[model samples]
Target chain A: MDVAIKEFILAMVVLDAGKVQGGGCPVFHAENSQEQQKTSLYLARILDGVVHDLENGVLLICRH
Target chain B: MEKYLIAVIAGTVSGFVDRWLMLRSDYRYYPTYPHAYLTHLALGFIAAGLGAVAIPALAKPDYVAVTFLVLAAQQFRDIRNMERETLSNLEKTKLIPRGTDYIEGIARVFEARNYLVILTALLNSAVVYSLGWQYVFLSAPLCFLLSLRLMAGSHIGDIAKIEAGQLHFDGSILKVNDVVIKNVGLPAEREKILREGMGVIIKPIDDNARLTLDAPGQRMAIIHDAVSILGSKVDVGEPHFAPLARKQIDQGYLALFMLANEPDLEYLMEIIKRVPVLESTRGTTLSSLYGRKAAD
Candidate 1:
């Protein structure tokens, strides 16, 4: 799916095993580009992190 | 006269046999035509000629001739550098580039094979010079066979168990065997992976095997070689659909997921079986020896 660049990743939350562990790796957190959400999603997948949309601007990644 | 004559013939034959075994294009159809084949063969002949004279020269009172072998080593180093540069340049033009580690491995193999030719020829010459023509006739074949054996390195099959695995979605999670590959939220992507993906589980036989498979570069080599042989169904742009190896870190097992052009499980497995175990990635529990008593 094609995600527009305008939205940008608002923030990333790391889940250790399933629990929210606060702000995740900054490398995956896009400061002002929604285009980075796609990248964050891909990196999360590589790490085998369970990703979820916690809210409108935040992404949650659960690493097992 | 017969001794030196036997050295020339047997040494040349031994070098040719070594080159014949090594100058292969099985992994990557490199050096594809008459030009490349002619070049390697000519170089092989030269290497043989150099080695054929070793015994005759060394046996003479002047030992200065041995210095040429040392010089030959410097030339082989250049050969390796050339191979590495050529492959690196060629890699940029390809869609799925062979990573630097694999490129380095191939370059090293080419350099070492030349030395193997030298060793085979020199040994054959020595045997003929010491014994006689009859001994070299037998010894040459024996030496050729030894070179063949030495040249054959270990493959993934030698150290790991590779088996076909099933891909299934647990809720929104995509998994191969028991390993969680990713969390697929899109049903379309899930369907695409399930319908097209070939899943394989590689179980390392020991701690050493686990460590070898653990490296990202080693896994990339496996994926590149397998996809190159089978033809990748996806392209460089499709990062989401690209072949990937996900490690089950707790147990140190690796699961490979790929959607290749062929999608033939048997073909994929056969190619994976033959992937050379990367020597640079080899690791063992004994590297640290923290758990063992010193005396043992």
Candidate 2:
């Protein structure tokens, strides 16, 4: 059977560098909210994932 | 032998016609290809032939010919497997898939349809043989009507009430009424969704209908059907715009959210209502004594 990662966070885009810590997935820190949304959209498109907001300053790209 | 010939012809013709009637290529887009139609028609003809010959083989006391009917039944089972495999293979490429429950229901219907053809043939031939060839006029139409009636299955509209739901966002979380659909991180995407999105609430009429809607597979079917007809804005990598059906949990109703190319609420609601209630996911809770007692 073919296997692949799903329902897992592929990458993270954060507005505050201090808000996120080191994890298995790569985290990209944006200079501002505009930069943050752009980075999330780019990451989501590249990773073939979806951008989901955590309702904080963090945005996650997850494959589902 | 001459007497049996007319019976066989009458049975085979009626059965083949019954198969042809059932092989409709509707809005579902299944069996749309000529080759697919040809394959099913050929199988239906074979099934009909087998049913037609059964009575004559017994009358002739040809025990060996009677055993072939069992082989025909085995052949029909393989048709179900063939249908299941083909649909499952095709499922991978679909943006929104008809879930396993729906696929199984469809495959089972294909198998059952052949059996119905056989029954129609058997009835026709039996009538023709017992009462003379003149009875074919009466028996053939009766069998056709019977097969049609038997083929009719319940649609979503029969069990549930569908209406337009309020599509809005609470912060970044998209919702249909109070049911949470999904979270969108991109503000632009949220705006597009708010502008183009449509929502519908499926309210089950009873506990049985609620349980049917509760199934993930059944919900997937509803989404798939609606998207297929109304068209969706979802693409390969963009999962945010994917049509989704989520349960309200407490109330046992379903909230469907979708960004459709057409974006017509009335058409979307109509499509959802017409979705075939998957047989595998069909609930019979109300039929059980305990379930009826619990509801009271």
Candidate 3:
């Protein structure tokens, strides 16, 4: 049987480094909104997850 | 011997024809392959033969042969298990899987159809044996009509009203009417969704209908059926574009959102209306005393 993680945050992309603190999932800091969006999109595709905006300058990639 | 031969032939032929009529390869594309058709038809023939022999076996007072009918029933039960396994395995590869409830419903239908086939054959044979071979024409059609009536369950249209819902992004959140469908982070993806997405609101006619639509499995079935017909923009990595059905907790209505390949809102609503209300998800809350009292 194939098994995979689901409904869990796989990674995070944030515009401001101070917005998100350290957590179990990897957090990527970007210079601006464009970079943050690009990083989140790439992370989402790579992790087979969806990008959800916390709307606090932080975007998280989660599998569901 | 001649009388029994006539009875069996009449019964088997009618029953096999009934099975063929019921096996439809529609937009769902199930049982599409010729091999699948062969499997079902072959099993149907066996069911028909068993049913056909039953009356004659009884006429001869051959209690031993009649016992084999019990074995045939056991074999039919295996068909349900076989169908469930095949469908569940297929579910893994589907972009929008037919939920377990839908799979169970389909599997149960397959098993039940065999039983219906047996009844048709038995009835036809009984008519031929008692009445006359000439009465085969009348009995066959009558049995077919009865089976057809029993086969049809219910459609979504019967329980709800489907209308086009407004699709818009509330900031990064996708909303179908007032229902929040999903949260998308990408600006480009959100734009694509706005351009291609379709939304429909399903208003349940009554409390029972509301409870039926409340089932997650039933919602999954609606999405699966709609996507199968309309085609979805969702791919392996693009989970955001996947079709979703969410209920409005306050009013008990459902809102569906999909970024479809065919973005025609009218056809999407039509497809949703035509979706079969799954047997397992049907709710009968109003039938109970407490539920009826609470509805007031």
Task: Tell me the TM-score of chain B in each candidate.
Answer: 0.90, 0.98, 0.98
Candidate 3 C-alpha lDDT tens digits along A1-64: 6786569999999888888887899989899999989998888888889999878898999989
- In angstroms, the error of model 2 at B269 is 1.0
Inter-residue clash pairs, candidate 1? A8-A33, A8-A34, B233-B261
Query: CA lDDT of B165 in candidate 1?
Result: 92
Question: TM-score order of candidates, best first?
Answer: 2, 3, 1
- Residue B158, model 3: Cα distance from true site in angstroms: 0.5
Q: For candidate 3, lDDT tens digit of each residue in B1-296?
A: 59999999999999999998888778887876798889999999999988988998999989999998887768999989999999999998998999999999999999999999999999999999989899999999999988989999898999999999999988988999899998998899989888888889999999899999999999999999988998998898778788889989899999999888888899988888888899999999999999999887
Candidate 2's clash total is 0
Interface RMSD of 3: 1.1
- In order, the Cα lDDT scores of the candidates are 0.74, 0.90, 0.90
Docking level for model 2: high
iRMS values in order, in angstroms? 6.4, 0.9, 1.1
- TM-scores of all predicted structures: 0.78, 0.97, 0.97
- Model 2 has an lDDT value of 0.90
Kindly indicate the candidate among 1 and 3 with the higher DockQ.
3
After superposition, candidate 1 runs with Cα above 4 Å error: A1-64, B1-5, B183-185, B291-296
The true-versus-predicted C-alpha distance at residue B42 of model 3, in Å, is 0.5
